[model samples]
Target: MILTGSRLEVMHFVGEKVEGYMKEFLKPVETYWQPADLLPDPTQENFLEEVKLLRESARELSYDYMAVLIGDTITEEALPTYESWLMEVEGVNQADYDQGWSKWVRAWTAEENRHGDLLNKFLYLSGRVNMRAMEQSTQYLISDGFDIGTGRDPYRNFVYTSFQELATNISHRRTATLAKQAGCPQLSKICGVIASDEMRHAKAYSAFIREVFAVDPSEMMLAFEDMMRKKIVMPAHFLRETGTKIGETFSHFSDAAQRLGVYTTIDYIEIMESLLNEWQIETVTDLNDAGQRARDYLVALPARLRRIADRTRIPTLEYPFSWIA
Candidate 1:
């Protein structure tokens, strides 16, 4: 993306494997479970009664849990921004319109499209969220877009997606666990499925990075280091509520997530650690001096991050979210 000649070549090389990766990572649309399968059907005879029961189960959920769920849903519902951004990446779309990279992005977006659909419908049935307010927030997030600092660089974008997918998997898995504990088995199952999808996607993206590291170790290492230096910003960093300024709602939403232990600083450090191990970063060799220093910074990063994480405190204050009223 930065006028690097090899970047486009590498993207083409990876694009060649799209068919295999698709088969391995993506489920067929016909066989895949749609949101309707997990949710009550409106056309069913007992649909009203089923929704009543679903609402009853949702009532048992904690306030923080509900808030975090709404935030996650909004983040997922802003899929259009992510898809558009990815499609514009340096080499992803420079090839044929029907190329593997384009197909992968579309298919991935299609699958991800269900996540927000399912969650939004469930929340609507739950009767806990202010749908109008929540919908407005989602619209704001998409309209506002975000600055994750990748700037169309495929290497940097892959790194961001790899970390993000794992983070979402963790949060969704935890939410699923809490949902089961809160006696909402249906929602728990829904989150479990979504978490599974995230895991598969994470594996796909991470594998792509692993391959890049093998061929372009120096550049790959530099990109990874650059991202860590930039501190991979979450996709929902621009999250805000109705009447709120840009990014004003993220702090409150993050606080709710931290308070609920759904997604926190500790979890963030763990994900970073896991990625380092997943990529075998410590073992990588053949780098230039700058790349070596970048590797060193990444090597000591987990401990440094842990110490910082230890000193930080999640705010004890609770804020009322407009989306929850």
Candidate 2:
């Protein structure tokens, strides 16, 4: 199929395989795990006892860990923003359900919805969170939204999602390990399951990019390069507390994450390296001059980023977050 560098053409070509992607990457709703499965059930006779035990385990978690978890939960809670953004991509038409991109968006959103649900409920029951403040932050994040530099292009959007999902997987996996070390086995399990979902989602987006590269190598390569040059910003980059300025809270939240080694600069560079490897950017052929230049820049970015990361330092000071009690 000769694509005329039309993003719509590429997206349409790839959208045809959405069903197969869903089958391979997403779990059926009925069989998939729900937040209720991991949380204390209200109707059970032992509900109060379970709640007590949950709180006791939560007490073992560190302040920084709690802050990072709360930030992650808020990011997940802004699902509406993400869904709406993807729906607006060039080839995705929410009204045209027959065109598979919209279906993929809805299905992907459905799977992602559980992440926030599970984390929010756990934080509320944990007795360590200021629920009202956390709720306020979530509201703010959704309202503020974010501009991740994709600008309605499917290729750039897929690249952003691919990177974001991998980053989320890393942070959640690290949190799971930390939770277990803190003796909070239940929380560890929650983070672990969420991390598993993220990894699957990452692979799905990465696959989409790989498919695009096969058919429209030059344009896809250029898109990948543009996003990397702009830097893939997180969905929660605009996160702010109730009275704080836009993005003020996120800096503190990020510092807490760095202090805990949940997600760091090194992880960002490694994700880039992994994507270059996964997409086999080095050996991609049939690229025009600009595309080849883009490929070269992307290929060399990881080593350059590593040098900057080595010189950078994370602040040791802890900032008090409004979300924590």
- Collision count for each candidate, in order: 0, 0
Candidate 2 deviant stretches above 4 angstroms: none
TM-score for every candidate vs. truth? 0.97, 0.99
- Top candidate on lDDT is 2
* Tens digit per residue, CA lDDT, model 1, 189-303: 9999999999999999999998788777888999999999899888999999888899989988899889888899988888989999999998997788888999999989989
Please name the candidate that would achieve the greatest TM-score relative to the true structure: 2
After TM-score superposition, what is the CA distance of residue 232 in candidate 1 from its true location, in Å? 1.4
lDDT of each: 0.92, 0.94
Candidate 2 per-residue C-alpha lDDT over 1-325 given as tens digits, one digit per residue, 9 for 90 to 100: 5477688878878888989999999999999899999999999999999999999999999999999999999999999999999999999999997777888899999999999999999999999999999999999899988999999989899999999999999999999999999999999999999999999999999999989988999999999999999998889999998889999999999999999999999999999999999999999998999999999999999999999999999999999898899
Model 1 ranges off by over 4 Å:
1-5
Model 2 gets an lDDT of 0.94
